[model samples]
Target: TVFGLVVKDYDGDGKKDIVLGGNFYQSKPEAGIYDASYGLLLKGDGKGGFTAVKPQVSGIVIKGAVRDIKEIKAGNNKLLIVAKNNDKTEVLSFK
Candidate 1:
């Protein structure tokens, strides 16, 4: 249930990486809430392959349902912005 995602070279390795965020909170009582995902960071290998990186390592932790992901520029720096439901927007910058 990926509602938001962004792709970029976050590690400066000349390869594209991925950031995924999503969660399903609306469900019947019997079905329960679907919140297994805690966000995902996929590091690309430049050969069309990717490796999963943990949140602690990647520094991209998303909670609640993700709505959108966008890239923005702030003067000389570029940043990744994350929007979530009932949560504060997050910003990520890479060097």
Candidate 2:
């Protein structure tokens, strides 16, 4: 299930990027209730295309098993996300 979704310029590339947070695709009992292992950072190209980029592989980690997520503006006006994990919540800044 998707807890939240927002399209913004995540990479400052002047194109609309996508930020999605939810659990892995499944239809289990806790699908959207407890599964917190799905958050995606999709970069956008100058055109109208987007690419899913895993933060961990890129040296970043935004663990799932997350409960909720929201997009916000950091103090510097950059795109950021606040997510609720299993027992705690964390913030992730878009790069």
lDDT of all the models against the reference? 0.83, 0.63
How many residue pairs collide in each prediction? 0, 5
How far off is residue 44 in model 1, in Å?
0.5
Error of 2 at 88 (Å): 1.6
lDDT: worst 10-residue window of model 2: 57-66
- Tens-digit per-residue lDDT, 21-56, candidate 1: 888788788988878777788999999999999888
lDDT of 2 by residue, 1-95 (tens): 56666788867768887777665434566544445545677788868778888866433355565556666776776545556545467666654
TM-score versus the correct structure, for each prediction: 0.84, 0.62
N/CA/C clash count, model 2:
5
Which stretch of 10 consecutive residues in model 1 shows the poorest summed lDDT? 73-82
> How many clashing pairs does model 1 include?
0
Roughly what TM-score does model 2 have, to 2 decimal places? Answer: 0.62
What is the lDDT, from 0 to 100, of the residue 48 in candidate 2? 79
